[model samples]
Target: MPMGCPFLSLRFSLFLSLSFATSSSPFSFFKLQSPSSSIPKATSSDLLSLLASPSHSSSVNPSVADELKSCFKFLVPFTPINTRSSSDFKSPSSRRSLLKSLRDEQNELIWWPPEPVLELARLAFDSGGDPDSIHRALDPTVMPVPDVEGSKEDKCELTRTPYGRRFISQELNSYLEYLFKLIVERGPDVGLKVSLNRYDLFHGHLFIATETGRLGILFHAKEYPLYDKQVFPYYLGYCQKDSNVTYDDSINLRNILWLAPLPSNSTQGWIAPGVLLVLDAHPGGIVYRDLIPEYVNVVRTIYEDDLGNVVVDVNYLNVGDSQPDYQIFIC
Candidate 1:
């Protein structure tokens, strides 16, 4: 391996070699081993239980820490798009290349006629009656399906973004929930492993728990701007509570554009929104913002009825293309 040769000169070779440890996917709800076990439909209590468990509070995993460091590197503006020596893996070129590709592929959705849920809710409020009557006046072809299925229906309907498949649901919580499944139950079972890698703006730093009540992994160094793009940065921290991912100290991602908050496109039948954005801070800790004069974007929230019906809850017409500051809570 020469100094800059495929292995010696570039770090990508070393990264490929780091998988010495391997892990990690999919199943139906009814077939699982839970209270319902049939559809994998987790109730509030189940979620609460997981959140209450201490296993989630483990010390940060070194790989995840490195990956996160890489993400912060991306927040820096036009840092040299060099290779990364991520964790045991060497070379950062792959991450830099991967991020450039991802950025190129991102696409924003269009603002449109207000979605049905919000429209219906408003109509009912104005008419002093349920908007159910609107059903008779419209065509059914455009109606939302009670249940959307895909290759991995049990996992979740995929999340979409201007940058391609970025999240599961439109709500922040929904996307986090999907991630929770992967990290907690799924990531550990097989050879799946997560690091704070190139998937910037998607997660904050977290430790993978090795046991019920002990620290398993640790990684991080207040190392900011961990990527070639260097557009966003976040301070990774361990959770104090079990299974709970709450950050006692508020993390502001507005310092860098890469970490800006994403719009929640729930009405599009997406389960969550904005779970992918990570943010950074300026030199003096001031959020450097741009007065973007663009407009005519929209966001919609959706609600479903128990009998298996879909409805819009609220919708907003965002006046510009810029994103807001938000904390990413990847379970």
Candidate 2:
């Protein structure tokens, strides 16, 4: 529900492109093509069907009741933002309506949107201030930012679009440096500037990502046909409170896989309206049983639904011998 909102999709068409080039017109470049014309993938109706089924009644233990919370890290309770509370903005009615979306829209690009840290970083960069001074001016929690402050102006130039740049004048070796020069040919403001390699998924135990919120531009292929007809796949991952781990993908919970679902941790899986999770499987993955107590219990009853949605129930959180002992992220 704030101003100048940022952060927000992907689909099965991933095999085609990695760089996000928005097609100006309705062209095949952006529009997703179906995987197989016949026997299409499952939609939200499947989950609703499962939930609505008599077999889904309160059981002694849910098929997924024993999962752990350590994986998610927080309880991101998203509340809808409506008309009355949005009258605060001074912009035209259109922009004001956007401002009013502060609550319900669930802007996922805003990891701790209240941090106001990036905006401060932007202001500092634009002001041509020292990185040291800028670093000192920030929240100690997310400090030591990109570390561009004290670097030489000649060494670190502000791209025309504004985010600071580590200019590489040399093109002696591979053209990668040249490519870097070309990629940001515009500026970081055009989109996220974090390193795609820094995505850190293949290297970590748990893959976690969150924002105070982000926009639900489209439904996650896995969680398709969202909760409502107008529903989209907007979710703010719960941050990790116990460990120092951060998520591997974009913090913005917009749909990453545009068409069919991303591969699941199980042999095959489907994620639906009720908390669908893609857990990394490995000793070093984020929700390893040894690392967290509740995770141990969760590993016990975890099963993929007929459609593959993970159905973790509350009892999983209350397990005795392996109840999660640490507080992860604050949803």
Candidate 3:
């Protein structure tokens, strides 16, 4: 647990109204909201009960449930551009070279006015209740595909279409609920002390530090960055087609991202506004969980809705499983 953890004070009836700071480094804690504030509060007990259960239950009060749902509104559904096994290249070198070429091409499309950029521009408008402005900000042009040698048209096809074709609505909701429950289970004191890894942040992967000197949860660190490009590539396109994929187990992509509090360090650079939390799974390679064994006693939560929809939620990476596929909670 963190030193003098504020979560302990939460039990004393504290109400936190969290808002990201609008600065180059936006990691500071904001002012607390009074009990009578319009923002709903998630009591310490309410959080603990959600955490204690393996799945989602309506046992908690409606206010806490509403707040939990609101946290996920800004999350953008996503998929990876390429995986190691998605091609028929016999050698690792061949696959690596091709993946790099594709990533470089996709990087050029992240500018404002594209599909994702256009969608992102609407978040503020939607929240502010200005529906008329959402479409006005979009650039409807179909982006031009990159023309590179070797794959040429194929590379262009991969670059322009890199996100997931279909959003996993049920799974995404379950993942967020499970994440919130984990924090509550850790208690307020423990949550305050969690740290973010600088190395992971630089590569856009998220690493959470739970205990005093150990690593917590690691999301989207499965694939090593391209040997030439030190920074891990972010996919602006969609998943590869199964017909073009020749690698074994290439289709087993479980995309999920953790949207949580990040610790700010002087060297980590600017924090982008309205960031989305999308978790990417490990490439077709051996999976490694936590480096430290002490942090590997995994606990999965199952949330059941009134409609009898069951969600057995597990974190992205399987930290302790010898065969990660079998241990994965989601099918």
Candidate 4:
């Protein structure tokens, strides 16, 4: 969570207001509305109901609605922070005790707006093209990456290995760049700014600055050798393993990307919790599988279940395969 420059922070916020003016104030601008305005104030329960209901009947684009439903079903229970409460703690003393026990678990429970998902989905569907198309338009060779010594010519490309190649192929890299720009272009409409924070080749982390938040996107290549039916748990186990063979000295396992929201103070100086999205590129296309439960499980095990994480994934182009469409795994 490196600190971003002040300019980056300002730009993100500024762009957000411009891009998302229609929906940015669901939380912040509530206080400014005139009392006599015909618009009714929205409650957390109301919002929850809206989110839980399928958008099949709505006038929204079918693709956008479908994408929204896929991504937001997991977030139905979350209430706005200003009006949030827990039924478990009945008494004031009990609430204080619970808070003390968890050392600010309440604070970690963050509230997020749902409008962005719809907006993002709109953009995705509007493109009229899929990730597969983008993937096919580029060269197949895995692009070479420079070595740690700042010499690309002298050292053999570290990512040239079969697994590495799959992880950072030229097409995927190009798609990544395109996606970043597309997301940023919506900043002004969404009332936030978007910028690149940094790309740490050493850690394989791509950081982005969005509105008042920063996101760290990790490139993960699923190892066929390590594949398991219970994929999420297995990946976490692998992330926890030490670098050495078991039953011997210390062995540190390679880090796998865990699905979670941006940290409180994530990349750059962003303080807001950004959205957590997963894109899985298989031979068929890029699929957006449901990872909400896995993300919550991982975050809760490592920390308290404060604010839950928001999960979003892109819909893949149907490649005429028998593989079923990705669905929301309600838990």
TM-scores for all predictions: 0.17, 0.18, 0.20, 0.22
Per-residue lDDT of model 4, residues 179-241, tens digit only: 334333432232223232111112233322222122233322111112122322122221222
Q: In model 4, what is the error at residue 160, expressed in angstroms? A: 10
- The sequence of per-residue lDDT tens digits that candidate 3 reaches over residues 1-331 is 0001222321111112112212332212322223454444444234222322122225666765544333221132222212222233122222223335532323222111123322323332233423223233333433232221212332222221321111133343243334433332322221121111111110112222221111112222111111111121112111111122121221112122332211112222111111233211122111111111111101000111111111121222222324322111221
Error of 1 at 228 (Å): 27
Per-residue lDDT for 251-274 in model 1, tens only? 222211111111112121211111
Query: Mind sharing the TM-score for model 2?
Result: 0.18
Off by over 4 Å in 4: 1-65, 71-204, 209-214, 219-331
Deviation from truth (RMSD, Å), model 1: 24.1
lDDT of 2 by residue, 24-139 (tens): 31212222222433323322222222222133223213322222222322112322222233232222122312334533222222222212322332333333333333334322
Please provide the root mean square deviation of candidate 2 (C-alpha atoms, Å).
23.0
Q: Scored by CA lDDT, what does every candidate get? A: 0.21, 0.21, 0.23, 0.24
Specify the poorest-scoring 10-residue window by lDDT in model 1. Answer: 293-302
Deviating ranges (above 4 Å) for candidate 2:
1-66, 74-103, 107-195, 198-331
